[model samples]
Target: MESKSKKQKMSALEQLKKFTVVVADTGDFEAMKLYKPTDATTNPSLMLSAAKLERYHYLIKEAVEHANKVATTTDEKITEAVDLLSVLFGREILNIVPGRVSTEIDARLSFDVDKSVKKALKIINLYEERGINKDRILIKLAATWEGIQAAKILEQKHNVHCNLTLMFSMVQAVACAEAGVTLISPFVGRILDWHVANTKASYDSTNDPGVISVSNIYNYYKKFNYNTVVMGASFRNIGEVKALAGCDLLTISPSLLEELENDTETITQKLNESEAKQTNIDKINIDESTFRWMLNEDAMATEKLSEGIRKFAADMVKLEVVVEDFIQILGK
Candidate 1:
């Protein structure tokens, strides 16, 4: 009776946490505190949303002041301010979560390897100045060819960790693992969005294209003995989150986390290394040309990756404008 009562008392969230690391996928500190995710991830869009809130205004002010003190030109100030703001949020998140935080590089720098590497290093430097170590930070970059290369340099040459975002296809995963990147966040919901829009069909959790993509990537990584962490991101529904329950990690929004917490039903492990290793699969080495060609061949991956970059880049510009407004007010 006691064991049965204890089992019944466990929420699905607690049960799921037993198998996988639950990462809060929002910039909301309150949500992060409530969910107590092991790690946290932030992007331009999430940061932009958080910046508009009154509670985060002080962070913006500090970032602007830091930028003004260091940078002479308006362009330099905006860049510095945005980077500082990202680090500031990351710092606060680190205080709440015991694990690391994934702070993004400027999305516009996604295609330029040199610029991306420089920006990543700058972000890491900013965090270090705040007394945060390199090990507790994961610099997020888009999974473009150049972004992967930049991550390679940061990981191998500089010993900085990286989380490659905007991932959709197997090619991106293979390339990231091959580059010795630290982690990869495959946007599960976005892939499902692409398939649903094209096919005009509804999918259950089991048959979700996004879930399948992550599962396949997980199996492949386990099969090949790749150490790159697979953290599923951008979930659209609780069903999708439930489907990828046993992923290495799942970065879920606060809403889904709440739902999982409220539901008392126990969930099953959907992915495990033992079962993954037994799956029959072939491995393909992804070179620069092969990666591009394969990515181009998959219309879904091609369109989604481009769209994700463009959207994040657009939000980055909007974030800069927010910083500019702060700069004007603070300068006055």
Candidate 2:
């Protein structure tokens, strides 16, 4: 007999298709298979956590072995290991997801325009050599001004798509859209995290600053008809996900995806262009200096942006160590 759970699950997928593109923001293949999200996103931090798991230990070992063969220096070995680990994860995710999988560049390259672009192209080239088409991958980069410029060049010259990460402000969003990047991941949970830490104030979804930030960006994008896709990322809870139901896309963590799957409740659309066009928002362009200055002025954005980069970079280093240890164990 058909189960009630099956019926409800079908209904949820039907409903989800109406409003947003659901993305699985995880490195766990088991979870992603169950959720059946359109795309998958991963960062060094998530990859590091996944590496510690027994199920994913093979990735570490494989990366280490691959690194040992070609690396002439310690730094080269580390970078090679990271790239291998990222590609392994990306390949696994691509097997499950029908759409793109975002593989992030090293966060340490966030502020270095040339290095970030070079690394991004390298990741794409690695994937292509493995028979993965460039269309199936989006190179993720920190949405610093430098990163945006790099994305611009990548888009124009190499025909590579980009997923701009760590975006915090309207300025950043506008800049990305203007640059002709493919996608933008505006962090919802991280913004809330900053607000809570800075103000010592509690916030509900309706009034949450993070919620407002995403909504504003969505509205702006829809208003101007930018081709860049807005994928709301780093959600804290199911509430944030439900609140932004009509966003172009939302990259949700495994726990939150589980929560949404378990609940049989309804999700309503909260954002659309008609409503966005009704608002009176003044649009402005910012140069590099002004963009940085504006970012610095927003205490929450300034702090969280720096903190996010450091956290991702530290995790990348830890992941490098794990890969190195695995290589040593394998006698590679």
Candidate 3:
């Protein structure tokens, strides 16, 4: 019994959970049950992938039936089906994770603040209809200028929480903080991808541009006393995950979560308020024009943001096709 106890050790993932709230970044419920993340985040791409699975086809059928009952035109039915499907997935995930589920607004609405806000309200209403409280949901927006503004209105006016995603720079992060956003998902792997593709250089976790971006944002938020949660997202590897051991939250993919669970490496806190307070970082207030100008100035950020939006939008289109096909089958 002494030898067995001596052999026991906490995995790197367990160590990470001590300092950071680990969020599962996949649509797979099985993965969520295994890793047991405090939160789960989903996007059009992930939903598109999950909707293709046979086990989840029931969800698609249910969504289609709900749409047929509520909507008039074919386009309207498709839209309703998509929205209902997202909430259905969120509802299912909420049952498993025991925390909030982030159901994203349509990426096509990323540039339209009014539409985004309306859709968010619609999503929240869907959740509420199923006895899920609004507090249990985080409406995900694209972190565009319009998205940030929508979040500001939702948070201040409607009492809705938001998670700003596709963020790649301090300009976006600072703007989000100023807007009193509930959370901001600064993507790490995508930033590293842009730098590597542009400069043709390799990077490790310590000096990774993505890691540096999140660390800087985390420090800035802490130093300035922002209440917004910094959730480091889109990690490419466990090394990047380990580097951000002390982030407020880290939404990791299942593959990386598996890696962390299998390895028993000791990790230390890399971010803390005490260290952040000691840093010589200056705070900058970002208004609309300055936000636009700053984002325009950062080539990598601009490119990546546009690319991320387009990819998500394209996947949303693909999801529409899937819904349309399923609707046809039902008609047959």
- Cα lDDT of candidate 3 equals 0.95
All candidates' lDDT scores?
A: 0.94, 0.86, 0.95
For model 1, the local distance difference test gives: 0.94
State the TM-score for model 1. 0.97
Q: Which pairs clash inside model 2? A: none
Error of 1 at 1 (Å): 14
RMSD of 2: 2.2
- lDDT (tens digit, per residue) of candidate 2 on 72-104: 777788789889789989999999999999999
lDDT leaderboard ranking: 3, 1, 2
- Candidate 2: regions farther than 4 A off: 1-14
Q: At residue 327, give the lDDT of candidate 2.
A: 63
Please report the TM-score between candidate 3 and the true structure: 0.98
Candidates 1 and 3, the one with greater TM-score:
3
Worst 10 residues of 3 by lDDT: 2-11
What's the lDDT for residue 325 in model 2?
76
Stretches of model 3 off by over 4 angstroms after superposition = 1-7
